[model samples]
Target chain A: MEFDLEFALETVGPLLMAFLQVTLVVTVAGSVVAALLGLIWAVCQRELPTPVRLPLSWVLDVIRMTPLPLQLLFAVAIFISFDGYRKFPDTDVETIGMILGVAVFAIHYSTYMAESYRAGIDSIRQGQWEAATALSLPRSRVWRAVIIPQALRATLPSLGNWAIAMFKDTPFLLVILVPEMVAKAKQLGGASYQYTEVFTVAGLIFLAASYPTAVLMRKLEKKLVY
Target chain B: MSDFFQAISDYSPYLWEGARVTLALSGGGAVVALVVAVVLGLCAISPVAVLRVGSRVIVEFFRGTSLVVQLFFLFYVFPLFGIDLPGMWCGIVGLGLNYGAYGSEVVRGSLNAVAKVQWESTTALSMSWPLAVRRVIWPQAWGLMLPGLNNLMVMLVKGTAVALLIGLHDLTYWVEVMRKDPEVGLWIAYGAGFLFYYLIALACSSGLRLLERRAQRRLGLAPSKTRTTRATAEAVA
Candidate 1:
């Protein structure tokens, strides 16, 4: 029950480096998926026909409302159940789990990304659309040349915010045993019975990564606002 | 399909009970978060430098870390310090403080959004600071804050799913328990859990939407930009 500073440091200090790699991998891979898929979602929500829009909207709403853990669980369960999954060699299963984890992370955050993009798009004046039309620009050209560039400036700050959020959230993959930093911390804590120190180190690691990034993000947001 | 039905029918009662616990935890956490948000939010904007800095540190520390770690810390680490509490309390407090840090920003943002003249007019009245804030600023800020707060409440409801790790028999836990049964498939179990969470969030958001409309009506800010202009007009005059 007592704090053991020396033991905790010795245990976590080495393991943190190993696990930090996993965390960074998931964050980078997931960010790519989220940034691309989220833009697609945002564009589709605005341009798709009513028949497509109505159901897609409802599906995104469900994803947004539900917890990520449940979604990740669903993904893991479904992914591993395939006959091909069993046939895959060693480490493949875990690799598949990591991929599914990224998919879930990307999918979940994309819903939010869509909302921010929509807000940015909406903030664009009605006059912009009319001007594009009066210029006889094709609809695609209007969106491409006229709209998306302006929308992106507004979206960058929010996208960066969600990236930071997704980075912190990568640890939730531990439920599926993705071997990220917190999972590593938990394993060390369980083995050594030094839950306080190990967990404190883990929290510090998260803050160290997130806090400075957030400060930079606020600065980025202010810069974008101008 | 038949097996899914059998699983649902078999676990329906347990699922209902777990859903009740989930709702209770989320509802309680939301209330706790709202109060903390108001206090800390006010503190963050207070004229006192120490109060502002103190609140900022607390808010950013909570915001920077993952909620799961916070829960783990409260549930696992706190007991070592002789501050042991039950799993349920840990869940409530952890969720409250983490989300409250977020909600405080919502509160501060909306408060700041209130016209600067309102604050000047309050100063002009020579009333106590609290009275001026309560009467002059809050009415305008409340409407703006509702949308952000409603969004936080939805996130909090989904956030309660972390309680499963701490061994609370919330909706997610019940779903997990059912999934362990050979008869209950994983899809059925986790799908039901997702649907339950979605429904609860939908209900809360719709309720908040109603409150938002009413607040806007009271402020006479609804039905477009004219009301904003009127407010600006008042500020000018």
Candidate 2:
């Protein structure tokens, strides 16, 4: 029951490292989905004439309005059900479920990011859009040439904050047995009956992973006028 | 079909019991977090270099980490250090600390949203720092932080979903338990849980907003930052 710092670190450190890799994998995959679907959602919001916008909006709403655990559970159940019926059976179902969960995570978050983009886009001053229209610059060209980069740069600090959040949030995957940091912490804790050093080290690793970027963000925010 | 309604008809009491526990956990955790967030939020904006840096470090450290890990750390990990907390209290403290970091930022931002001129006026009035803060600054910050504080409470409710992981029988955990009953079906269980959560969240948010507006009426203040953060993060985002 006593805290043994050295022995605990020796035991749980490597395991936490492995789980941190799982966290990294989930973060990357989820970031990709967020970026891709984020852009799609952005485009849909801009080009509202498309018939698909309503359903897409509803899907995003469902994704956003629900909690991540419910989403994760739903994702796991759906993947299990769907995989049970079709696709190669028992072939990396956890991996599939994790990806789906991450995608759900991405979509859930990207709605927030989409608002950031919308804010950044709004910051362009309506005159710029008017000028683009006046110059006969196609709407697509205007967004590509004049908007996206600036919107992205303006959105970087906020987006980085969310990236760190998504990393922190990877722990919820333990419910599905994805073996991320918290999951690994629990495994190591139970295996050794020493949860103290294991989860403390895990928390420190999470802090290490995220704090520098936040410091850098504050610095970046000060550098930018807007 | 009949069994589904009967199960809910009978099991409604257990579900309500669980929801009450969830409410107590969320409600108590929120009060502790509110005081902590305000103090830390002010410390975050402290003129003293040491205070500001220390506060920032603690804030980022908590916010950057996972809530469930923090909860597990308290429950399972603390006992390894010879400190035992009951499961529900452990859950509450973990959630309070984690969401308190988020709340601190909200509080800090809303406080700063007050004008530099207001500070100048307090200085012009030749008031002591505490006097200035209590009389002039805090009222303005209250209007600003109210909506944000409400939203943070809602986010805390959402974050409480993680308690399901550590096997604390919150609303989500109970719904998860209900999912075991084949009579009601899994999706129905989950759907009912979602509906329960959405109703609670919607009511909490709308109630907070109503209170916020009432407070605004009493204070005669309207600030942009508080309104936007409340609208975006708490209710919608």
Per-residue lDDT tens digits for candidate 1, residues A1-226, read 6678897788666557845567877887887788788788888998999999999999999998898888887787776566547676665666777888889998998887777777778778999999999999999999999999998887777777787878877778877777788888878888856888888888888888888887786777678755
Query: How close is chain B to the truth by TM-score, in each candidate?
Result: 0.89, 0.88
lDDT of 1 by residue, B1-237 (tens): 787777888888999999888888898899889998898888987889999999989988888888889999998888878899899899899989988888888888778888999898888889787897788788888898887788788888988888877888888778878777767777788878877899999999889878888989999875232112111111111
Q: Which stretches of candidate 1 lie over 4 Å from their true place?
A: B1-6, B180-182, B223-237
Error at B141, model 2, angstroms = 2.1
What is the overall TM-score of model 1 with all chains considered together? 0.93
Model 2: per-residue lDDT, tens digit, B150-170?
756766777777777767777
Clashing pairs in 2: none
Please report the candidate that would top TM-score against the real structure: 1
What TM-score goes with each of the models?
0.93, 0.88
Clashing pairs in 1: none
